[model samples]
Target: MNNMRISPAVISKLCCLPAFYFFMFCSLAAYGDDSALNIELKLLQVLNLDAENDQQKMLGISSIRFLPSADPSKGNLILLSDDTGAVENAYGIFETPHTFDVAIECNNHVDGEVCQYEENYTRDDLHYPPLFTEAGLNQDQIDSNNLWCSMFYVGSFFIDSSPVCESDIEGIELLSGGQERLVMEEQVVGFTFSTPAVLHLDAQNFVTHKYTFPFSIFGFKRNWSNQNTQKTGVRPNGGFEGIALLPGEEGLYAAVTEFPLMQDAHLNRFVLFSLEESGNRMEDKVMIREHYSYNVDKVLPEGAAVVKPGYPKTGVSDILAVHNKRRSFITIERTAIRYINRSISSVNKLFLINLPDSSDQFSSSELPTMSVIKKEIPIDSDVMNNYNIEGLTWGPELAGGNKTLIMVNDNDAGRASQLTKIFIFEVVNL
Candidate 1:
């Protein structure tokens, strides 16, 4: 429960009048389905409260994906706090999250603050328990295929002290009976990312250690400063949304969302690193010196609309980047899917970039780019109405080896909107 408090001003920028509310209504509708991994987005759940204990009403869910240390079918669901503040430092303020490990035993089982919506509930009274329901999907519906996957949360949170150091206090605890443990807590160790990114891994089947980074070593680095680092260093133009451990390689790779909040004029970037197990703990993960960056404005110049990045590009920010096994480094843009050709045996590096305009909005038109593929997946207009597309993960493969794309939207915790419309798309060869 690393609660990072945000400023009221920043919170204002993230809020939309009717756009946000529309998305919230659509999101709850998408999650209400009981079965069928339908491409059509439906509300999975909803939260409504207006009383003293409202904070406990709905443990806002952020991202959902399979964890390595558990059954392939069951994954871990993470939620962020509703308080308006920076996400990285929010854990320091309100440290409790309503988290649930998606398991067979917990299927559709309602308990605690999450019961059917009562007419007495309203947002005015600042109620306690929120209302929620299990994902409309069931085991049989999603059991048609066998595959491995994991997802990480990467977003901006106005932070104060240090997220690493303060995560261990009793305040921060996983809500689902502590399924997601507090692996490491530390102060800012050194800013490894221009954008905030979380490392997620699928330990093949089940994993023992769910926490992947060196939180302890980082926490001990007392000199690290969150404010100074963000101002001076490379703050991600697009937030770090996509994360994946490249097979045959050492560490992990992630996609950075769009630049400068929604419009970055610099280079589109992606980070690479290796995760090494140190004496029974996760630590010493080094970032690849040679990273990958592309120009987006140069590619899609057809009046690129205001939108966040998506899977390998989405998350809270825009860019969610990841590699498809031995293929290429896939970078999701606001309008297209761009890939850099790199053989598995080749030294880990970006392959090409022949461009001119270097501004954050500079698209790649004249250069001999690697490979840019446009996506055919139809977006849920309701979810993308206010915030940009946020969550993106290479979904589980089907029974016939065809690949599917699993995407989610950022509810900004429960502050902005809530839509459990996890998009499912089958990749068709272009």
Candidate 2:
């Protein structure tokens, strides 16, 4: 006798609001399939960060992140930029973003609304040559691809105090996890960018130090792990383009080869790195942990008309590890196809990667191609217009459950045809 009778008025109201009674009327609504990876995005707002007008701040943006704040409204946003100016590696930290224009959706995704950042600190080449050269990095290597950052936080808490991007911390430290170089053979070899630069900023955003927290070759410096890339290596400027801190795992991080190691050109390799400290914090090291493989898709579907003969230029640009989940991540696979005199066509799609729960779950022998990674395209090309999207991060949360996924594009060192852009959208299950 749990008899709860609903009045006609109540029933009428519930009927009028289908969404309000969705769970109660499950039989009438389409059920969700857990097997399928389904993610939906609703465009909420878009803005630009150029109100400050610094070319390095506006031009070659790579990744964006929020330095933790205790108060819901006080968090600071930091944007990493490439060495487009050849002056120094730079990034900007700003207060909450407020100014913007109205956003409009295009054929693929929403585009619009100019927003600017109220900068609190602009850190660039504060201590360039020393920080980089300590790990044997040269000037050219330091400037190429630096300062694409992804904060390692678990629900406002830092994974560890290694860099102090947390609420109660005083200083800020970030990794230049953008593209590095890969070399083959020996001395007559090409440049090898197997290291991620470390930039330390004091409380007021003044540069304190700069250096490389290096990754290696056969567990040695300047080598890009045991991938033995010496046979056939990553394309120029195509090494370690994507990086993320593994959620729930402290001091453990992940980086992926921008394109596949030339050996498995069709499959991208994801490598794990862990931080180990010595007596001195500056001398701490990031070493290789594990390796997993993922299959890459064509720039366009099989039957789509393409004007290119080779794979062209395609690879993962940046990675964002899902905060609540242990081993899942958001992978941005992008490609640029240029015609001699035709418009350059691009493919930028977002994929969901759920790595195996345990390292022992699968062996390399099992992978004819070591492409055992579980992947599904949650946001397909059909839903987004083609743009050379380089980076993404979790913006402010909208309803505690839904999050704002902010993505940015690189303007190729300020090219006329390519305008630096930022895109914001409401993401579910992200």
Candidate 3:
């Protein structure tokens, strides 16, 4: 202490060094401990089985919606299966290097001697279920009718015989329009009938309506009536392939894909409908209407559907709408191949489309200018070839103005795998 003294500037400079070191250590700690920064994508959950033992398969998950839960940190996830049923067992249970077969038989004819024949059909061959039909039938009859109707239309088994061992009249009554009448005529002799075998005469029971079938034989006539109702709005004639919850409205938007398999050629657009909430329960209102049209072919990747010609080249596979800081909506378009195995080999595309204010109308013109977010994203992987990306929604918010996006794959196609994967991605600047 030989009268040595430091100036204020020197003292200040010396104080800054430790502060800098402290900040550096803190930053390093955050960088090391924070999981959101290191990886762009993370696997959250894998839902393989539902309550009924139906394993999630290829294109199994068509839509996803996030419902507000009591805990702000968590949300109830509602998943819509593209089609509810077992994955089409194309190959035998013991077959290796599993492959899809339109029709497979266990035994073959050897030297003109008939052997045991075990036939296996793919889901594609036995189309899932029609999106629209008369209701009121029990679940068993509904399923039988769905199978017979699919067989009648897809397999060209237009005869009156039921593919399933059930009453043909039960399935015939479920059909709509002339098909119902045509099928019923085969069962009813000496009777001339009109379309709409089951006619909705009244609208008192909005949830469930009454359908009447009029018949006459030998100057005797009577009105046969049946009750039919829809659970969630009018069952979409087209498959419910995509859904987006309205940010600040009492409704959600849904999309019906334009593939030939759905058999709904007229519905190639998005629909906006309100949801009726009763305490903890929610049901769709019967007031859904067209919202917008997003053509899939406009952004179809080249050579995408070459492997599966039957699959639609372009269709809206999934949709997610969120509001930007400007109070305008931005939609994420997830387009994918429609086939099961082919979708694995094909690449899916995602686009960002800006929407007008929620009060304003949506136009197809906005689609042409939509910006591409990620192009050429493969639905399949080296480990899993039948993974088809379908469901997408906004996940929990992340730090640094970044948002998280969650997507799920439908894995029930070529292989009978029970694993359905959920992927999380961090959305950075545009």
Candidate 4:
């Protein structure tokens, strides 16, 4: 049994904070100092969901993917956020600021209707650069890549508000922006096909045009009202989390953090769902569950830091590894990172489970397999106790390619969170 004890001071510390209430309304953002930290290993940016401004309180980051362009820096970084719940639902381009502008998804001030767009946006006067650069592209290419093909996908979480419910695909281009051109028309096919409510958009575009079945797949499904739902819904919950889009498929496999700070539960989960060709309702979504045990006294008598031989090992000193060599999907639970004192730190031990043939345990039809490539993370400290692990990306498979694994944490939008760190590692023979 886990001890659910908390000192009165810790309780008071949480109750007195207004940000805690704000978290109920918005997802927690990744809080870190603006001053660059010298991350000697792989680095991942934390999206502070509670951020009050683009430069501050980094709110939930909707997407993070590499833009395979000739110039890596110019248009290589693609990042977006709803921007503090302002302008109904607004999206802005990161990596470049001069050409950035906001796209409205809904007008909250409107009366009687919910989650409906009082207006829309376009690229003709796109009002922003690197904004919808692919606008006016071949419809066939858009369909093949599962790109939104429009300036933006807008609609409500409620079903009856629009003709095409759950409409969220917004296209982008160098096209300019204007109200007459945008709000004047709506995608009739979108509204006609699904409920105006419950539509969602992708956070980042995959390098390729479609989905691929790389391994045994597991997806998440939940009440549309849940936070995870909101994050992936027409609106989103925020973070630089990972989602894989495979070849020739419209479905997305998204990995989400299942635990939060101060929570006693240790079980973490991820979900998978498919979007229609029209980018509407998730067609056959599923849930993937993984339970991690951190009972230090019982499981690690020699301490979690002591590794058993024959497990994956590396000469990388200054990092922790014990039974780190294993094959399975990996998730970092911040709640599992523990602190022994200000100077000494202890982290939750990482665990693994074999993949089952059927995904029947999940709510959806897709089942993930054990055939995954496990890369030991470069968490220098025992990654057993902290609660903010929020980022994950697979390394390149071939030699001379990037075989790096990285993870970052959410600081819970507080000064205490400024200590959040990103850890990097490489995969070798296990």
Candidate 5:
């Protein structure tokens, strides 16, 4: 039943290591934990993956996590991909070990056999016939027409793309030939893990279960788009941005929305969903156990000279649960801007919030927002010149009370040659 694959080296190590050593091995692999209790991250080093300046359309890796490695210097990094829309029915997958290639792979060019990189991006696949007539699309049509669900985009026939999406009689499109296709706004919403996991430089141990959330969140407030409906939810490009698995609870996860929902403009909404495996992947429903709102600090950063300054540009990027501690996490808040041709960020900061267990769903109750009261931890722009820091996670442990912390820049904006930067920090005072 556990049909996952791993390298022989890992198999050898796991086979010979004592039972407690198994836990030790797992300890070496950070479970994205840190209580965020009075901890400080000291700058150690910065590595530019695009030193050759080659990454192009494929360079935007929104989030990242490190594969387990004994040698911290040589581990392969797992970079999550372009943040948008639902993909497929994948579940009961990661257990023994799963291998995935991460980041930009340059098939187009190379130097001395080591592939140089270029990422090709396109958004022309939004038209689908199956979505129009309850026709049910083929796998290719389903995959090609990545379903978009943010408030800004809506579909003609609705289909399974959005909760607000229902059959619109007049909205169907009849092509010149006999065929018909559905018309939808080109811009898609929702976030799914995209690509690049180096199998050679990696040891595999990842998510034990696949996760799925409400399609409504993607195309929230889509009733405005629907011929006759108005269900307000997510903002444009602001669907589920982060996922943190609860420590003690099975299948329980904290799903973080990037910005405030249309109804909850004052704070960011965090919804808790419980996933249960079933015979049908499509039938794999997420139970909304509870939700909460976190009051965000929109105040701009205090620096000598800020690069990009936009009030509406601020939002939460990612969240990570502290190890061994339930309901504890550190959230990444970013205030970004466009400087010249590059998409630079003026602010990068972290706030610690310990969420409580068992809360009323945000929409159902009139509850006060939970403010992040911990002292602000700002990753100095001077020290970290490369901006747009979207992802952060605990790395391999270090000597003494100090631990290794790794943060990755999205290279979210700018041209193809934008440098992909990964920051290393010495986390002290744990």
Candidate 6:
């Protein structure tokens, strides 16, 4: 029998070899499989819809949806318009502060017509004045304040234009026509509210609908009035900033940022509603409400004053609910002041939130709290510098079972930068 003795140096090298091999194996496995860390973003297209005049700049796209077309190879983009300024009044009197829908075709071709307009729905054709008046708003006041309903944003499935659950089942007819045609359900839905005034639009038309309820709906002791003061404890200005329809569920979730004027308010609230259809209007019944207090100071830049005396630190820019999953992705856009020169800079971060499983009943008193998973996705500085990125939606499916994320910015009014940019990135793991 022969006994072999290896030197200490040789033994150590052999031991290190196994560890190195294991590390490489794990790395290779992750690269091959669907892993979050391995997720890669690919910029596919940058559709520019800007024109020579201010009226033609398609920059104020606050909400976007990648609608499935008859041809699977091609996809349609539906954008909901909103104001870029803090107040809609920034658009001069001659420039009507109206919101509309613009549908464009996005194909594999990278030609000039790759993003040509397919259809246009003007505010006149989509605005429903009665929806506000029906909510106890005085028509005279609405007109006096120049408070016209404008679509702030939109949310829906990637393939379907409507919510996962038919809003009509809740006894609300969303279409101006009849519910006999289910195809109308696929129409783009928008949300409008009293912006810069306080009242929030919870939901809007199938493509743009704003639903308002008394503060009491959320267990608050305030009535809907035009006081423009927080003494009512009622949020009059911040309404439906972001929206996401729950996948494979009968629920619709929306986010409303607390008015910057509210002294004691630091939390942004998410309201859950049951989507129902009412004639020409999508009716949303408030189910439950949950609030999240974001750490603005941690997310903001140096010398930033997120919690100002009368300004909101962060706003819910956009929200997207992943397909066939109970997860919601939210983007928060924060404004900060630079320490050295007091210059203002914008910061954007994405939050992946886990939603509760669907149940037959939801109680307002005990709403489920959404927990954030990942919050490190940063918006490109160039995009933030030139435009306010407010619109976000799930893009079409990509090769290798990956997904796409589409973001659009709202270019400020009267800017000579007639370049509306669309950022497209493929989601590898998500």
User: What would the TM-scores of all predictions be?
Assistant: 0.40, 0.62, 0.41, 0.34, 0.57, 0.57
Write candidate 3's Cα lDDT for 161-185 as tens digits. 4322111111111112111111111
Residue-wise C-alpha lDDT for candidate 1, range 127-170, written one tens digit per residue = 11111121442444223211011122111221332221111100
Question: For each candidate, how many residue pairs have backbone atoms clashing (under 3 Å)?
Answer: 89, 9, 4, 78, 19, 31
Query: Compared with the true structure, what per-residue lDDT tens digits does model 4 show for residues 1-430?
Result: 3223344355335323342122111111112212111112222222222333434333323222222223211122222322211122223422111111212111122453211211121111111112133545454543433333232232212212211112221111110111111110112122321111112222222211222111122112212344452222111221113333322323323233222111222222233344333242223113233322121111222345534342221110011111232212333322232223322222332222222233333342221322221222212223313433433333222223333343334343232334433333433322
The per-model lDDT (C-alpha) reads 0.29, 0.46, 0.31, 0.25, 0.43, 0.40
Order the numbered candidates by TM-score, best leading: 2, 6, 5, 3, 1, 4
Q: In model 6, what is the error at residue 130, expressed in angstroms?
A: 4.6
Error of 5 at 274 (Å): 1.7
Alpha carbon RMSD to native, model 3: 19.8
Worst 10 residues of 4 by lDDT: 177-186
What's the distance in Å from true for residue 342, model 1? 45
Ranking by lDDT: 2, 5, 6, 3, 1, 4
Model 3 spans > 4 angstroms off: 1-59, 67-76, 82-238, 252-267, 275-285, 288-291, 297-312, 325-344, 357-386, 399-401, 413-418
- Cα displacement (angstroms), candidate 6, residue 118, comes to 6.9
Residues 93-188 of candidate 5: C-alpha lDDT, one tens digit per residue: 111111123332211223432222123222121221222322455556543443222222222223354222111110111112112221111123
- Cα lDDT for residue 395, model 1? 40
TM-score of 6: 0.57
* Top-scoring candidate (TM-score): 2
RMSD, every candidate, angstroms: 18.0, 12.9, 19.8, 18.3, 15.5, 12.7
State which candidate has the highest lDDT.
2
